[model samples]
Target: MVVQTESFVMLSIVLFVLGAMGVLLRRNAIMVFMSIELMLNAANLALVAFARYWGNETGQLFVFFVITVAAAEVAVGLALIVAIFRSKRSINIDELHEMKG
Candidate 1:
């Protein structure tokens, strides 16, 4: 019932890469937001693994802060998405240029 640090780190890396790809390749705003969340979770996973290996609570504690910031980000991000969709009728990022003026 033991897990290897390398295994966890590798998993984290894979998840982060997948998230990054989604963000880079997708056009939908919601999809990109979910991808960002995925990346954050992957980072948190790695942090927890390292904290466990080091026999310390610091990583877990930092994860809590990350979670808090994520919550705030979600609130603000969703609000902005809604506002943009209301006016533009689409969540496509390419439409963002209209707001430049």
Candidate 2:
């Protein structure tokens, strides 16, 4: 059981790293946002796994908080994305640079 839990955590960590890499390397805004969500989900998975392995409820509570925050973030982010799309007609991260000034 311990070995299985450890392997699950390792896999989740690898997936989180890949998602981080995708967020860093992708130029598309939507893809980057999706990658960020993927990373969050991966962490949630790890937390739940650890909670089950250790027989603790704290990890589950933490996962709940994470999910709440992720939901709020996605809502606000998508709204902003829509506004940007309406103004610029493009979802590319590079195009957003012009808005800095």
Writing each residue's lDDT as its tens digit, candidate 1 over 12-86 gives 999999999999999999999999999999999999999999989999998999999999999999999999999
Q: Model 1's lDDT to the true fold?
A: 0.94
Model 2 has how many clashing residue pairs? 0
Predicted structure with the largest TM-score when compared to the true one: 1
Q: Which one is best on lDDT?
A: 1
Q: Once model 2 is optimally superposed onto the true structure by TM-score, how far is the C-alpha of residue 43 displaced, in angstroms? A: 0.5
Report lDDT (CA) for all predictions: 0.94, 0.92
